[model samples]
Target: MRVWAKSGVAFNGVIAVVVGLGCALFALMAGLAWPAIVATSVALAGIAWLMTIRQDIRRHFVVKHPFPDEWHEILNRSVSFYRKLDEPAKRRFERDVQIFLGEQRIYGVEGQEVPIETKLLVAASAATLSHGRPDWEWGRTRDIVVYPKAFNDEYDVADGAKIAGMVQEHGPILFSDRDLKYGYQRSADGYNVGLHELAHVVDLEDGRADGIPGDLNWMAAMPWTDRIHKDLTNKHGRHLKRLLGNYAYTNEAEFFAVSVEAFFERPKKLEQRDPELYRLLSHYFNVDPRTGRVIEPVD
Candidate 1:
C-alpha cells in the first residue's frame, strides 16, 4: 500500500527554500550588498510560501461561490444527514462540500468517469462527518479511488471480491462505486460503506488504528478503550452486538467504524440502546446526529 501524508506544507517549505536560494544566488552574481541580498531572499521566499498555499486560498474563495442547485438536489435526495441540518448548518455543510470537492482529488479508476452525483455523495459523507467539527480537515494527502465494483486484497475487481471500501494506513482510500451508491440509497440501514471507511480514516489520524480515536483526550481515551475492550470481550452486553451486528466484533477498528455507521445512520436507536456509547460518540463528534446540530456544551 502506498503511504500518504499531508505534503502541502512540506511542498510549500521546499518551494520557499528554492526560491530564497535562487534569489540569493542571483543577488550574489550581481554583487548586491549582503543586506539587500538577505532582504530580497526573504521577500521571494514569502511570496513562494503564499504561492504554494494557493490551494488553500482557492478553497477560501471556493466556499464563497454559489453552491450549485444540482449538488443541492443530490444531497437532498440521497443524504438524510444533510437533509436534517438546520439552515445555517446546511449552508456550512454546502460550503464544506464545495471546499472538499475543490481541494481533494476524487477520480475513477481505469478511465471510468465519475459522475457528479457520485462525487457529491462522497463530499456529503465528508461533510456529515465534520459538520460539527469545523476545525477538522481532510488534508490534501490521499486520493479517493473509485472502483466499478468491490475489489479484493490484491485490488482486483472481479467476481467473489468482498471488499467494498478501504482506508489504508497513510495510504489512498478505495471505494466501490456500486457500494457507495447503495450506501446513500439506503440512508437508514446503518450499513454505509462510505461512513465506515471514512471512520477508519479518522481512526488513523493518530497514526494507529487502535480503538481510541485521535480526538479523545486521556480522560476520554481511557473510557473509550475500556469500552472497546469490554465490547470486544462481549462485556458491554448484547445491545452493542444487536445495534452494530456481528461484523463489528471483527476487531476494535471495525467496531469503531461500525459504531460510527450506527451513530450517524441510526442515532436515535443507538442512543436508546447504548446511551454511554452514544454519549461518547456525541462528545467526540460534538453533534447530535438526530438533529444534525452541534451539541450544546453541558455546563
Candidate 2:
C-alpha cells in the first residue's frame, strides 16, 4: 500500500535509511567497504523518487475503486459544488475526490478530530479548482495539517486575526478547522481560506507565488500577467474593492487567491462586475462558474 505523510509527520523512511548509512560509518572507519554505502545510498534515492511519484502511482489504481456511499452522503451534505456538477462530471468529481483523499493525509491537531465531512469538503475544494483540467492533480502539496482554529507561527493560541489557512513552499499546508468549515459553509463574498490557501499552493508549484501559475502557457501567461499587474495596482479603486476586496491588494499572491474564491464562490457577480477579468480567469481555470461550461482557449 501507498501512504503520504505531511513533512513533519513522516520522515522516518528517509531518516531510517540515512541513520543506517550513518551507522555504516563505524564499519567504514574500520575500513569495512564503501561499496555497501553506495548501494544503500542508491536504495534511499530510489525510495525518495518513489515517494515523489507516488501520486501518479496512486492515480493508476485510484480509478479502480469507486467512491463509497459514505463519501457520497458526506459530499451531498457538505459540498455544494459537487451537487451542482453535471451527472457525468459528478462521477468524475467523485473519482478525483477519491484520488485526492488517497494521495494526501489530513491530520487533526490538539486532539481535534477531523470528521469525514471535513475530509470531503477539503477534497471538494481541490476538485472544484481542477474540475476543468482532466489530468490536473494536486502535485504541490502532500499533506494537510488541520488545527482547531487559526494560529500564529510561534503562538499556540487560535488568533483569527493572524492566519486561517496557509500553504508553505516545500512544506505541508495548515488550516484552521473552524475557518475551513466557515469557508465552505458560506458560498460567496470571496473569502474562503481553504481555496485561497490551495491557490497559493498551485501558484508555488513553479517555485514562486508571484501570481504566475505553472499551468498556464507563455501565450496565456503574458496577457494574464499584464492584467494581473494592472489589477494589482488598481485593487484600491472603489469599483474593484467590491469584487477583489482590500485584502487582495496585499500582493499579487493574495489577488490570485482572493480572486479564485470569487471565481468559484461569486462567479456571477465577478462576471457581471468585470467581464474582462472574469474571462481571463475563466479561460485560465478552463471553467465558467456561472453556467459550468468549459470555454476553449482562442489559439
Q: What number of clashing residue pairs does each candidate have, in the order they appear?
A: 1, 0
Per-residue lDDT of candidate 1, residues 200-226 (tens digit): 988888878885677666786998988
On a 0 to 1 TM-score scale, where does candidate 2 land against the true structure? 0.76
lDDT of 2 by residue, 1-299 (tens): 11233352246456655656665665577675688766665666567656665655666678788678898887777666777777877877787788777778888875568987777778888888878766555773467888777788763654444788788778888887788888877776677877888888878877788876767777867876887888887843557667777888898888888888998889888777767778878877788787555576311
List pairs with backbone clashes in candidate 2: none
Which portions of model 1 show Cα errors greater than 4 Å? 1-55, 296-299
Q: What is the C-alpha RMSD of each candidate to the true structure, in Å?
A: 5.3, 8.1
Q: Which 10 consecutive positions of candidate 2 have the poorest summed lDDT?
A: 1-10
As for candidate 1, its clashing pairs are 4-170
